[model samples]
Target: MNKTRILDVKYALTQILYFASFSALMGYASVYLLGQGVSNSLIGTTLALVSIIAVFTQPMAASAVDKKVIKLQSLVNIILIGTVILSLCLYFFELPTMMLLCVFVGIVTFMMTVQPLFNSMAFLFEKYGIQINYGLARGLGSAAYALASAVLGYLVEDFGTGVIPLFYIIGNILLIIVVYTYVVPKNQQHLVQHEQQNKEETEQKQLSFFQFCALYKKFMIFVVGVVLVFFTHTIINNFFIQVITPIGGTESQMGIAVFIAAIVELPAMAMFNIMRKKINCARLLKLSVVMFALKHLLTFLATNIFMIYVAQVLQIGAYAIFIPASVYYVNEVISKQDLVKGQSMVTVGITASGIIANFAGGILLDAVGVYHLLMIGVVVSVVGGLIVFGSIEKKKANVME
Candidate 1:
């Protein structure tokens, strides 16, 4: 195959492996903890810890990539290896509760950092005139996630939650093989050097945190809107199993529900390039937030498991479109010198929201119940949607004048 075709195939395969690993952990980690007799509140605490650590880890990882402290592929490989080792340690050592929580926190911290690295690398490659087809690659990742969730759901049901770590190990192993075999080493070196040159050209001295904030004030407002949307999104994702279980959904059914949610993302993600051609990223983001609110509303009203599946169909607009749109929006708004930092800022929003969602969702899930918690999500999501809509409208109006 030609170089472009080869790179495209490698990128697609890498995405599939990356997301499959993510699904094995994030998709079922809570349910696995539940099966292990962990309380809903504690599960929330664990997830919150993961998000909190990720708040620090993602920015650090992004900085490392930008500064050439480590190559992108090298960083990814190291994390995946750490993940595999941690998964095995969690399973075999069967450590005390606190230690297990610590391991889980490490695993998720590493996993959360991976996406930003992938995104930054994709943009860097594109900047160098390489064609990676990020939308299609991300779509394939969603497809892999769906398949892994469904199959692992059944496996977890038949074998046990202990199977979760095993799946992580297997997924990470495949990811390592793909990265080492198909990924071209020279391309990575070129991307890293290019990023470093841009950084040095734009920044002779690193700005203080306050200086950086002042420079990106408008982008900071946009980040706040993104955080609000994810605040609701993270709640639903972390507590999805809890939401369905009270309605008689089993382990396998939980898998099916996630499967439906992820599968629907495929077509929307695959068509993101076309959608971007027709719709500006800001409008697409606004639409996504609105759909996010609607999805929560429908889930709040769902009385049966089937209705939950119906609600998941909205994932197309909510999550599928949101992912690509947000990436494009960041690239459009942020300067090249601050590219990695900008992407990390967006991830920080997501991680911060996840922190709130896990802690609050856990507390509410235990005190009130799933239905009541979902109602809170609906209210928050609508407010978030309005915030995003207003922000986008004001920006447009300013441009018109």
Candidate 2:
């Protein structure tokens, strides 16, 4: 057993545990809360608050990691531990609506804000001279999410929503155990010093935030397209029950639908390496944006529960390709010095859209209905795809030309 194989397995385990925790909380919190007597409008509002808080806090946390205030793995462990404690808090105590919402928001926000850190950890062990297969690990993470969804649906059905926090506690604890077990036998103190020194050197040469914006205005436009395109994703994911309820889908079916959606992602990702042999990444990125619009169009036209599944199958072309393609896009276009923030801009675009969609989806559902919201999603996503298509037509220097 080679070191790479060992690290890959460890990372895959970590991803599985982390994503399963995500599924139990974020994926089904609406169902859980509704069972607890929370309203749909308030549910959406609560989720929006999670994204809102994350938008402000995640950067500060990331900056702390950047400045070496904390090590990445150590920070992740601390968060996982914090999540477990909060999950237990939710498990043991029954609270009033306001307090329950506040506590629930904290649990989800902690899990959600730490998402990028998990991705970055895929490359963390590279400093140890061994790189894990990130794509493989990420695909397995999807598998974990899919399994968790189906099982949680059953659990919510039979055991009631009370089991939600129990799952949260279990998942986070397992993740913590995994984190501590994956030890880098190399000199930890030496690596810490090396990392801090590199960060300090990078800090000295780092461009001002305004300059990064000015120099990469084209990428900023690209981020706009990301936020718009992701608005469609946010609606479908966060407001999934609303999408299906009018057509008579239940929690179990919603779980299955989510399962189908997530299960397909892994195979799509697995085939990406082969797909790259036939299609260049830039074209794939544009096609993915177009495919995102197509998915929204299908969702809009869906009148039956079966049609919803059909729309989910479209993830094969949309998100599955976009994830890897966007990473390549940043590397190809952005300077190395700005690469970290460049990736962050793309993530921030998604989070920003999440805030908008979450806040709006609840209101729209309360005011109009699901179909009206789906129609808006279809139109908005189509325009978003166009912006992405045009935004990446040339590199930054030639955009005006």
Candidate 3:
């Protein structure tokens, strides 16, 4: 194969492994915690702690990459090594509550940072003239997530929740191999050249963090809208097992629900490039926000497990489009020098949403029940969608004026 084809294949394979590893670590975290005798409130607290760590660490990770304090490959290596070590530790050794909490925090910190860092690398590669079929690769990643969730569901059923750490170790090990063996050599030259170019461009005065925030006020608004939407999204995601259990769904069925949610994204993500040619990213994002509200409404109204399955189908309009669209929107709106920071800002929004969701979803699920919690999601999603719509409209009006 030619170099481009080879690079494309490697990138795609890397995405599959990357997201599969993520799925293995995070997809069933709540269920595994519950199985370990942790209460729902404690599980939520754990997740909130993870999010708090992410809030601080994600920006540091992005800044490190942006400033060349660590190369992308080096960062990936560090994360993979940490993940493997932690997974092995968790699997082979039983620890106290504090120790387990520390391990969980470490694992989440690495996983949360990986997505944005890898995404920034993809953007850098594209800027360097590498033809990455990002949508197709991302779709494959979603498929891998679905497959992993299904397999993990079965494994959890048969072997117990202890299987979680085993899968984490295996997935990260494979990811390490893929990075060292396949991805590194293919893209090293481009990355080096891109770094050199960035160095040359860095002679200009860099904006202070406060100044940067001031300058991107509009973009910040968009980020706030994203925060609101994901607030609801995270609640649904974290509490989904609870939602279906009342309707007689087992672990396997929960896996199927996750699979359904993930698989439906494939077509939408695969077609993202084609769709972007027709609809602009801003409008696409607005539409996604609307769909997100609809999805929450449907989920809130779901009476049985099948209804929840049907609701998962709406993942196409919600996350499938949102992912690619967010990437494009940020790339187009943010300058090259601030690209990593910009992506990190988006990650911050997501993590913040997750923090709120975990804390609130956990408490509410315990206090009022799943239906009431879902109704809260419905209300929040609608408000979020309207906020995005208004923001987009105002931006357009300002441009016209």
Candidate 4:
């Protein structure tokens, strides 16, 4: 294989491990916590608090990278080191069930904090003259998530949630090794991504998010849309065990549902670039946002486990297209220097939506019931989809070329 192809493989491996590790937290952490006797409301509170912290930490880390205070690799390494240490603690130490949840919260927070960096890693290789197959890599990453959730469903069923820590430990260890092993071609190693206008001026300017929002009004609109649309999906992902409960789904069935969702995402995400060739990204993004509502509506109306699985099949039109489209939309709207901030802002919006879902979804589940929650999700998802549909801009959307 050529050098770029080799880098592509390594990059894909890193994505595989990263998503596999994090899927444990998103897919099964609630199951594990509930197994440990953590109350539903308390589990939601844990996720809320962690997401609130991530809201601030992601921007700070992004600013540090912008100022060149730390390289992306080093920052990712630090987060991974902390994650491994925390996961080990969760595994070896028998703490109060609350403390175990706390440790798991730490791992989740670290994973959330580092995700934008992982996304940014693709652009990092552009400096080395190797354009990694990001869509293909991400598609495979989702496949890994599918496989992991499938196996973990049974493992947690047979062995216990102890396997959560094992997944984290093994996945991160492989990730750390793979992250550093990608080859940088000697010819492009020292190339600067862009020429500077004035080093002093750029260094003095702070990374102000509000400024970007003010200058780019549509971006703020986009952020709000993202928050709204993500609210139900984030809840579904985090509390999936609960999501399928109303339909009499088992952990194995939940795994199958999740596996179907992630597996279906592969082709849509991998083919995103080709899809862009045939259709404007704005149209695709709008369609995907609308599909988000449709997917939830199906889930809301599902009366059987099979119905729920059919709902999972909608992942192709929903998140699969939205993921790559959002990236393209942000790149189109935001300046190159502010791109990380733009991406971080998107993450913050999703996290903020997650914060709402975690805080409310739990208490709501405890107070009301799962189907009632689904009713609310159905209503809000439609509202969110409308907002997002309006938020997409057609002007300059064709600039992907």
TM-score of 1: 0.85
Residue 10 deviation, candidate 3, in Å?
A: 3.2
lDDT of 4 by residue, 279-316 (tens): 87788889898789888988889889998888899999
lDDT scores of the candidates, listed in order: 0.81, 0.83, 0.79, 0.81
Residue 238 lDDT (model 3): 75
Q: Go through the candidates in order and give the clash count of each.
A: 0, 0, 0, 0
Tens-digit lDDT string for candidate 3 (241-328):
7877877777787888899999998888878889988998889988899889888888888777888788889889999889888877
What TM-score would every model get versus the actual structure?
Answer: 0.85, 0.89, 0.84, 0.86
Error of 1 at 283 (Å): 4.2
lDDT of 3 at 102: 80
Put down candidate 2 lDDT per residue, 1-401, tens digits, no spaces.
58678778989998898899899898887788887898778888999999999887776776677666887778888887888888898899988999989889988888977887877676566656677877778778889999999888888778888998999799899899988877664465357546856875786587777888898887888889888899989888887877888888878878888998899888778888798778877799998988889889988888888998898888889998999888777877887767777877897788889888888888887788889989988888988888887778434452211
Q: After superposition, which runs of candidate 1 have C-alpha atoms over 4 Å from their true positions?
A: 1-4, 65-68, 120-130, 182-191, 194-197, 200-222, 276-283, 327-346, 394-401
Give candidate 1's error at residue 276 in angstroms. Answer: 4.8
Best by TM-score: 2
Give the number of colliding residue pairs in candidate 1.
Answer: 0
TM-score ranking from best candidate downward = 2, 4, 1, 3
Better of 3 and 4 by lDDT: 4
lDDT of 2: 0.83
